[model samples]
Target: MKSANDQATALLEFRLSAHRTLGPKERDLISHLSWRVEELPARQTFIHDGDKPAHSCLVLAGVVARTQYTAGGQRQILSVHIPGDMPDLQSLHIGRMDHDLETVSATQIAFIPHKDLNHLCAISQTLNATFWRESLIDAALHRAAIFRNAQLDADSRLAHFLCEMHFRHKAVGLVDEEGFSFPLSQELMGEVLGLTIVSINRSSQTLRSLDLIRMQKGHIQVLDVDGLVRFGQFDGTFLHQRFDHETLARAS
Candidate 1:
């Protein structure tokens, strides 16, 4: 177990980096707000459709899936929440959540109450803009996913997902050039890609044959990053250009 001081230091560092674009006063307000860290077991539901969100969740570790069920009882995965992502940003303006947020593995999350968050944002214009910027970026990612799903073939879809994950992992400082830790099961991946587990497995083999990617013991390694990007037909603009030029300039 980590000591209180260690955890405090970790949270401080995370806050500094996450909101680096904010001014010193804005950062101080964020630090003054109380944040509770909670651990959730695999398969646990954090938020469900029609539920009023009480707090915003920041994924600290492990994967979470945002899924929606059709009238026919089939589930469609909207997005997978990883570390450094705010899974409940929609709650800021929306009164109730429209999808289910559930953990794929034992996960740790930091909960920031909506009321306190509103107060913090109200006090800091920078934080308010930052919050909305993140929301817009999330919307763009959803749009990209929709387009990819509609246009890309199954093999290409799998490749695109891998490339997207690689970049996201890199954004959070979790990826090396080869790849990063990918712990999701094939079935979960299938849900996200709208593919059968068998199809996903077949595509995985195809990628391996192409010498583009390799997976073992839940860790994925991109053997040829350039080749994988070409196979996926990936455009990094969607992932990398999340922040505005001014915000990035300030952060730098």
Candidate 2:
């Protein structure tokens, strides 16, 4: 039987494996932190707009949505959060939240206090670097979204989003040739793409007809990887893979 310490160590390893540059000391710090596991039901709100956030959450399972509401009560979905993602790290440092984070499925999250995270970073340079990398990736995604909105057509935007999600999922070991389970509905996708549901459905159908992607239930499969890449105009450089020798060379 695995001891409690051993189990905790394994969990930390699993969680931190996505950070290719994380070392043993950082992993040890992560394991030492007490984590509160909470189950978030589908459509439940984790962070509300204008609310002072208390703790930063690390997603363990299921999907979370970061959204914003308009003055007229319209809601826009900004992004979707997956496992191994920390959705509100920016709020922790800023002291106030600008958007809402809600669960789109029955989700599990590990809650870490902001103070605890700060203390951990003070003690571990490796942990600090990991956090910095995560923040940079988040900012890069936002920048990509802004650029896509400016330059891409609705069809191209949808394709790019799907391709980006597929690549990110694969990086975190959550995807295969048949894409990972995406718990988003058409309405949610529409909000993210700034399209109507009718438009999203039409675009999805178009992709299916072209044999680039297939969706069954909640699962998506990239039927033709090369075709999808070409259609999406995707370049994987935005993913910021720390362990990639090419990426390291570029950084240097």
Scored by TM-score, the top model is 2
TM-score (C-alpha) between model 1 and the true structure: 0.88
lDDT of 1 by residue, 1-252 (tens): 864333433443353455445567875776576678888999888899999987987787788889999999988889987876887889978979999999988988888789987987788777777777777778878987997789888888989989888777666666765577877788878989999999999999999999999987678888887998888888877764432222212322
**What C-alpha lDDT values do all the predictions have?**
0.77, 0.77
Stretches of candidate 1 off by over 4 Å are 1-20, 241-252
lDDT of 2 at 24: 72
Give the C-alpha lDDT of model 1. 0.77
Which 10 consecutive residues of model 1 have the lowest summed lDDT?
A: 243-252
Model 1: clashing residue pairs? none
Clashing pairs in 2: none
Candidate 2 local lDDT, 101-163, one digit each (tens): 999999988777888889987998777767877878888888878877778887888888888
- In model 2, the number of clashes is 0
